[model samples]
Target: MSETSDAAKAAQSVEAEYASAEQPPALDTDAEDVGLMAVPATAAGLPATAQGHFAVVNANGTLARGFGVVSSSRLALGQYQVIFIQPVTRSAYTATIGLTGSVGASPPGEIAVVGRAGNANGVFVQTWNSAGAPADRAFHLHVSS
Candidate 1:
């Protein structure tokens, strides 16, 4: 009879493979820039004054997925801006600590949102750890006019 691989043997094989592996790429947790993000053409037609739009932002200020969102940028530690295709000045904003991908629970943190200075179609977002220091966090943002 043929025998299946044992768990210990499989683990040893994996460890052997890892011994020759190169260093993994750096994580994006605190990346200064993720470069220019590609926005879908559909986002352009979205009215700047549209309501009920939302964005899922990654820890590095990249847009995971969003409706009526054009782009995102990391301005400073724990400070980011979400740019919309339409104006959000008359809209109410809400943000929550969350993940950009399917990864489980997010780290506990505080989030705040406000209108971007000198920009009507932008919203500034800030994140902080439980200790109230600047922190990188994934989040979801919603806007309702």
Candidate 2:
């Protein structure tokens, strides 16, 4: 058989196999499926149990878009850490991080710089007061409702 005819026969065989194969079920948002999951409703300012949350807030308390998480349940009464993967440009002394969302009538949770590295010293320090301007730092937050 000629190469052209052989190629056509191969293509036809492949197409026939695909045509006889069962198709995948349609995506159902209401139900969970492979590679898909439902997002549970959660209170504001709480991270989802399944996924971590991310945000970028300015010194003036301005939060960038795509900030926050969806938790399946309310945040427990405990401490949570906000690690800065990409530390802000502002000095840690001047930088402040806090949580904002529906936390009943009480004020939002308070977060302070608990651990950080000094830009000049390059040494990790445990500080309660906000200080330094490290490139990467994390804050420890106390959440109480």
lDDT of 2 at 29: 54
Write down the worst ten-residue block by lDDT for model 1. 32-41
* Candidate 2: clashing pairs of residues: none
Best by lDDT: 1
Which segments of model 2 are wrong by more than 4 Å? Answer: 23-51, 56-61, 64-145
Q: Write model 2 residue lDDT over 48-132, tens digit each, in one string.
A: 5433334333222233322231111111222222333333223232223333342323223333333333332111222122333
Instruction: Please provide, for model 1 over 34-105, each residue's C-alpha lDDT reduced to its tens digit, 9 standing for 90 to 100.
Output: 444423334666445446789999999989999889999888999999999888998899999999888688
lDDT scores in order: 0.88, 0.35
TM-score of each: 0.65, 0.24
Decoy 1 TM-score against native: 0.65
